[model samples]
Target chain A: MTNAIEVTGLRKAYGSVQAVKGIDFYVERGKLFAFLGPNGAGKSTTIDILCTFLRPDAGTVRIGAYRLGEEDRQIRGMIGAVFQDGLLDPLLTVEENLRLRGGFYDLRGRALTQAVEDIMKQVGVSDLRRRPYGKLSGGQRRRCDIARALVHAPEILFLDEPTTGLDPQTRKSVWQTLHGIQREKGMTVFLTTHYMEEAAAADYVLVMDHGEIAAKGTPSQLKDAYARDKLILVCHDTARTAARLREKGLACTETADTLELPLASTLDALPIIQDLREEIRDFEVIRGTMDDAFLAIAGEAIRE
Target chain B: MMGFALRNLKVFFRDKAAVFFSLLSTFIIIGLYALFLGDVWTSNYEGVPGIRYLMDSWIIAGLLTATSVTATMGAFGIMVEDRGKKVVKDFVVSPLQRRSMVGGYVLSAVTVGVVMSVVTVVLGEVYIVINGGDWLGASELCQVLGLILLSTLTNSAMVFFVVTFFSSTNAFATASTIIGTVIGFLTGIYLPIGSLPETVQWVVKLFPPSHAAALFRQVMMAEPMAEAFATAPAQTADAFREMMGVQLVFGSTEMPAWGSLLVLLATALLFYGLSVVVLSRKAR
Candidate 1:
């Protein structure tokens, strides 16, 4: 019924470079909103301004019921953030780190202890509570980082590229954990990421490029408007297959091992597959994805 | 603010290496004095009654003053390390007030300065008594302890101001090394101010910790000083006290104990006000 975050004409600059330029967006409460952009885009800058880490040159921002600059303390109390860098003290144990972070929010004594235990358990890191933060694996440390931010039971969570350096399996598990927490707590999540599939899971997506919002919409809507599903054929000889398709006036792009023919509809796959017969080693009519939606809208692939 | 301050203290104490390195300069000064400088100074004052007591007290007082400066420098290193690793940003984004954050760091520095300086005083007293010197009386010991608090406040405030220019731990370490080497000369411990050129003596007199050192020696070495100069003419005893840096002389006017104490108090207040202004501006 209300917006979790609202911004209008938010602008920020560093010397000669404009990091965020007159951006406007609002995320609904209890929804997972993904902010997607390539390298050097304004995604991180926007998040920093919203989280009160950096002061914007000009803007009107409201987080829940609190104003950005004027009521920053209240806004900070309502939000939790996992920074792009490791914020945990390496020498401190996981439990010690959690308690210290809890102390920052003025949570202490039995109440602090209980909150720390509950958050650690909720993030599946209760068993690692006594372990030193430096000794934990990357995935484990991330779990602890998330648990630290959640100790205060913030109403909104800001995750800045939370899974950037994690391995694929670890990334997937973190995603699942994030989804689980969001679903269970019904807290608003504002995420910035370069992974399209991660953004694909969001109820709403905002794509930024070169300090401006290039596009914003739901995944399905963007896919319908700008992206098309492709019928991909992985063959022993994709060059010959591509030549054959081109002779028939069917436009297809060929890579080393596959030929990608954009399909207007799923029904078109039936005729193409039947005509190819034994020439096709393997084929699948893949559905449209946020990757395509992003490429079509942002005009560049997401840089790692 | 208390929680943040306590967290800093815990982090400093838990890191054995940091704790050791923070007091490393103090130990080095004492070690060098015991091995080489101690004999040289004692030989110069040979046959002066209670010379061992007076000279030992002088070096120990200087060491105590140095301890607060060096230990506070070490304590501020945590702030630099946290900034380098971006851990400070975590605090910035939290609900903690900016004043509280600055206050936490300032309080931690003061705590470290006082705690480590007290330990140094204990060690110095042990060494003095082993070398056949007497401990201070109740009133004298209270005066020494009171000076420790004021000296630590001044040192903490001064160091906090210096650290604001640094964000990287490596740069801060370099600054710490520079301070460690230069502070001895400024405080007139490495070389007595009377033996130096007049301009150099002026510099030492103007240095804040030099005043602290003067205050510490005045109270700590009073009994020994009285005994050593008991038979000498009043002017000669006054001259010896000035030469040894137990009393500060600017031109012909001798600075009284109250003057040095006032200088220390003013130094503490001025630097603390400047540090707060700088921290608040940076917060903005």
Candidate 2:
């Protein structure tokens, strides 16, 4: 597949602090690409540069065939951005907000009205059409923001923490709506999120830390790399078993009543299992998680 | 561009404080003027008769409309709100032309000006007729309307320029009030510019409101433009006439009126260009 977004050696600094330090990544067309990072890890900054809201100090960004700087207008026309903030006017009704956005693309009259109605219905906010935007709940406001972004029918959608501050159920609904749009329109979606579950939903993921890409691959690829082969040992006292195993030169972590150990091979796990049967109440082997991959790559717990 | 302009107008009307204050303030000023000057309308001042005094009432109405509407905090509100909400980023990235965006804002200001002017004219005329003064004829009424429109345009442009370049709403407000008050005093909105000190008269004559007031007085009070020109010294009159001659070359002989409009249009264009440049640089 052709790349939808290509960036090379991107570097951005704020005074003495470096925000994006020579990071590189590419996102394939028509795929949902997730950018995972900590709060100050330059996710928003990179997205800003890509969305034409900020000019990169030094880098090459190519969205489709258009280069960043040289073809910003054309690139901007092809992309729709839902920024971190809800940029809708508080004074305008939901429908009015959409109509005003649609006007930017020269849509007006009956055509504009119909377009707004269709988008609102598609986003499941048609009932709130006449309501002022400030009156809507957080989720409804985000949905309206998304609909406004799509008013111009852009080829790519850039969402910067679209579900931040949302409840779980609302976040799920937003994901579902985004998935529906992607399925129906085949628009490339570039999303930045702190939620691991949201990151797992992407077709590909790029884990960022300290202004650099720590790792990039499919979710399963990352999981397999860090956690595919793992053995879980449940015992009467996990701490005792963990100490005994460590004393015997085995790597293990105790969690409540369970002991987890990274096994080089299933054959290597058999001896430990056989020897520890007396101390173990139960044992099982399982696949790894995206969180484990992130921890392994960033050298820190995902939640922290 | 039409969409932008219409949207701004809709938003302005939806603002309760803006709509209420604009209409309320215009009526309050006219009511106060009528209460104080009701008896004076039937008496003669200088060589002008009582009817002429009543006609000249439109000048006060026009000035009040211009001062109140042009001194509105709407421009600052709009710009500051856009900056705070980051809505300006959307426009900067959109395909909408920069000039069109400025035009939309200016048009919104003009709409407010026109609305306020209409309210003052209607209420002021009602008071004149009810208090035993002759009603204005169609031609005279049209002249008053024209003058009000010109004054509104001029002041709106000035406000637009001030709000565009200054980021601080407080600073804009302070500056607008000082400028508006000074112009009002120097032009003798409550007195006569001819009675001001020579230095103050020179300074006031340079103000758009002074020219605007003079033009309005000429049209509504039936005073000859030449008589209005005499308020300034001979050298100043020559310079003023030459400036008017330039306006005449552009197919308009209403010097003070057209001069204010031209200055307003030019300043609007300049502020708009500067805004675009600043936005572009910041976007980078």
Candidate 3:
């Protein structure tokens, strides 16, 4: 089967400032892809182009079989987007908004009604269908937003910061819902997020910075390439413990109370911890996280 | 197009405050006319037969035109609210054409304008009859209805054009408040045209909605004025019509009823064309 989307040298600029400068990537069907970036890193501009809301300055894009500019309406028919804000009318009930969206795709009568009901049930929003969207709770509103996107049953769903403002428990629930939908329907999901832990859940990840792609790979591959595992030690004598580790050809940095060692991999921490048992009072071996890997690649921690 | 238009209408009517505020100016005018303006104007021709009926018909005609203008402006609030919240971006990304969405808003406003104007005319007629004026003849009522439809279309086009430049709800509110106050004077209801200075009277004549008011007055008050001034001279009635703005004169030329209708039609076309051009240019 063809890839869900493809873009080559996509570039978009507003006046003199370039928002997305000549980028290339593609998403396979049925894959969850995460595009990670800080503010002004061009993730939004790129997503805007992919969602057909913006035109690239110089590049070509193929969404399924249709070209971006030449066949935007057809692409619009095949994809849906959940924007960061104001995607649904606040005064309208959730069911009404979904029905309106379904009607926009030319679905009518029983089909539109059925689509709205099915999607609401799927997104766990059936009980809130009659509530005005503005009156919904935070988590309820987010689920309704997702249901709004699925009313037309688009093949690809583009989520822009889907869980940005939700609490941790709500965020986890939304992700579970997304994963369930992607698996059950074999739909492709493309999401951009500032939360590193969220990107760790994606099948593939692309990190962008300064209007360019800083890195792209699966979460494990990125962690392996750019992050390192750490072995931390609190001992009777922190200074002496560090010296003893350096004598064994293992480098360590000594804090006032602990000796820190960076290992080549998580398994490397086993032998080092075992060897330092006598000198250590307590120890912890911490594996690399998506945050650490991102910091290594972007040269700074992701800011909220 | 029809689906979106229906959505706009549903949203508008569902918001109870929107429906009430759209007719707010009409209610305010009726109250002011009864409380103070009524005694002042009717006192001039105290003993003239049918004078109260004539003045009542006259103010109601002006109120009908004012209703069309204000009600349509209120209906555009939905569009302005959507734009302010950036919900229009969602519609843009959908499969619907941008032109169709804009058409939906304009059509809904026209519907609201016509509905509000018709309600005003109905109530105004009842009030006139209660004041002892005879009901309009069949042909006269037909002419009045036709004028209401024309006035609504012209006002909708004009309102759409003006609303294009305002997206924030605060700006819309401020504009509405200003238009609500100014429309009364422009319709020559608050202050009669002949009583105003020569320059401001020119503004009242040039305004397209004022012409709608004139056309309405010509149809609605014709019989009552004729009866009231039967023993009086023709010059006396003509002068009274001119003073009260039952008819509008432009630069020493008395404009016929057809001339005012032409002005309404021409301004509607001009504004609609300008609106299309402005919208197309604004699009990427």
Question: Mind giving the per-residue lDDT tens digits that candidate 2 earns over B1-284?
Answer: 77887777777778787566434433444464556643353242343334434334544544553444443445435665576567877776666766687777777677667666666667656665665555666897887777677667666755665565666656655665555445446555543444456676557556655556565554554432344434556665444333322121122334555665565456546555665676566444
The 0-to-1 C-alpha lDDT of every candidate, in the order given, reads 0.89, 0.71, 0.89
What is every candidate's alpha-carbon RMSD to the true fold?
2.0, 6.0, 1.9
How does model 1 do on interface RMSD, in angstroms? 1.1
For model 3, what is the error of residue B266's alpha carbon versus the real structure, in angstroms, after optimal superposition? 1.1
Candidate 3 colliding pairs: none
Off by over 4 Å in 2: A14-17, A226-239, A253-288, A295-304, B21-59, B62-76, B168-187, B190-200, B223-284
Write model 3 residue lDDT over B94-136, tens digit each, in one string.
8988888999999889988988888888888898899888788
DockQ category of candidate 1: medium
Cand. 1: chain B TM-score: 0.97
Tens digit per residue, CA lDDT, model 3, A5-46: 898999988899988889889999999999987888899999
Number of the top candidate by DockQ?
Answer: 1
lDDT of 1 at B128: 91
State how far residue A69 of model 3 sits from its true place (Å): 0.9
Interface RMSD of each: 1.1, 1.6, 1.2
lDDT accuracy of residue B162 in candidate 3: 91
